[model samples]
Target: MPAVTSAPADSQRPDTKPRRRVGRPAAAVLDQDGITAAALQLIQKSGYDGFTMAALARTLNVAPSALYNHVSSKRDVLVLVQDHLTSLVDVSAFESEPWERAVRDWAWSYRDVFSKHTPLIPVIAVLPVTDAPKTLAMYEAVSAGFSRAGFPQERIISAIVAFESFIFGSAYDVTAPADIFDSGSMAATTPHFTSAVARLAEQGFESQADVAFSLGLKALIAGLGGFRA
Candidate 1:
């Protein structure tokens, strides 16, 4: 071998070490939908108490700092989640049906949506509808229905709030156990209540909660109809 120059010591040795990347691996392209989906997954897996920005970042395989680049705070993530959930409520009935019928269908759909995401109820209930476009859109549709029904501008929000309160309560009630009203040891002390419970079942109510919700919703629709001009 004529003048075979030895290779550099670094190159001569086997390349055992992995090449270092130039900077932090680029995080997946974060967006409102991706962030909201991750946050929802965290909530579903760990619930509200366990969900956090850090948890969401980990779920997305990104640093917490990277998560902040998209959502400023947990509330921001929640607003996205709320908007997604609210969009599922059926507002199409407003297009063709009477306002009362539209409200009934929308209320039932809304209650069902939140019932499955019960932990979100409190968070979404208190959050301002500002900046939540889907939530606002749903409200807009509902408000227009009320307006077409001749509800006064001043009373529209109050009526909507009242219906929401009832819907929220019914959503929570869905999680109650079948025996939630069972009066085991106190059965003897409360004849009227116990008898009523028995009568509720005897009358073929699907569930105590369901019956209560139906009764209350019917009354609320009728009562709110009174506000129509």
Candidate 2:
């Protein structure tokens, strides 16, 4: 008869319980959607830097290690938040519309998404796109809309890039805090800015903000068409 061999510490230890499943342990008992939702709430309430994995774990009543079971890092959470925002955009908004309307609607939707998550605006701009399906799907739909709008393939892609750049740039400027314009110095500092503000009255621009968006968007579309023609 062969001698009986002792089990390893994990197996032989009576205090240790049997493993629950074959896969990796979950970070939390709740599902991934729940975690992602919680993360959004946290960011909305406290801003990005204010939130931490430890704090999230405390809120979820799980060990911090468990969070890694669902998210790889804070960067991963940021990506998920961006993905969630993009998913909220209505792709149907682009369907059955003329090229200009479809493209404009898409630009407005992109602007709205960024505006809603102002804190994440920079992050979205910088986040590396690694097979992000929702983001890619939005782009593909916009591209298809442009194609149907009679734009050549190159122009279609160019139109999408130009549209996105305009949207992000415009939203960032509009949403930036007003203190940036509050310096007391006149000709001594930012003379060009002072001159620009002075010209605002002469230009009879009652609402520069609204006018800028409309003018920029129209010009972008016109430029795209001109590029192809």
Candidate 3:
């Protein structure tokens, strides 16, 4: 037989370039943690108006369909974001501390977590907890503490809702300017309000938000504590 010339070594070598996937992955490369992290970072940089499935996919170097494999819609991603953020709140306090102390720790932690992520508050506020296991878990922990303290069954959800409304709105307050209460040119006409603001400044605190938060949180705990049996 005629000698067969050996093919060029380079020609026989396998292509080094990555092969394009022909079908769905054997295991999904995207998971909720990865998607939620990317979505959080993207939202922080772009704001909610600019956040989209396409934008998130681009951030992860994948196609939008890849995200759909993990999350059904933008709302699903928002639920993930809310749940992840809630996981950072100090629910551990509910387990170890007295109810009042636990409430303080949890409230402050929740406010701090979302203060940095106020942009997500609108979506988080509306996202249902039915699908957010982690978020629901936080509620469960808090609710258990409430029940332990003899909080009425019918009032638990309502009470938690009241705390959350205060906490979420406080997150926005954290972003307000130090002089947000200043009447400016109208200060002369609003002497009582201006004087109150001036006296608050005289307290030597570094942050107006901190003062208001402390006052509001104290009031909430007192009001809600009455419901505890």
Ranking by lDDT: 1, 3, 2
Per-model C-alpha lDDT, please? 0.91, 0.73, 0.90
Score candidate 2 by TM-score against the native: 0.70
Clashes in predicted model 3: 0
Candidate 2 lDDT, 12-126, residue by residue in tens = 6676557578776565476667777878778778887878998777777788887888888877777777778888776665688766676677777778777767777767876
Compose the digit string of candidate 1's lDDT tens values, residues 86-176. 9999999999999878998999999989999988888899999889999999999999999999999999999999999999999999999
Specify the poorest-scoring 10-residue window by lDDT in model 2. 178-187
Which residue runs does candidate 3 get wrong by more than 4 Å? 1-29
- How does candidate 1 score on lDDT? 0.91
**What residue pairs are clashing in model 3?**
none
For model 3, the local distance difference test gives 0.90
- RMSDs, each prediction? 4.1, 10.0, 4.6
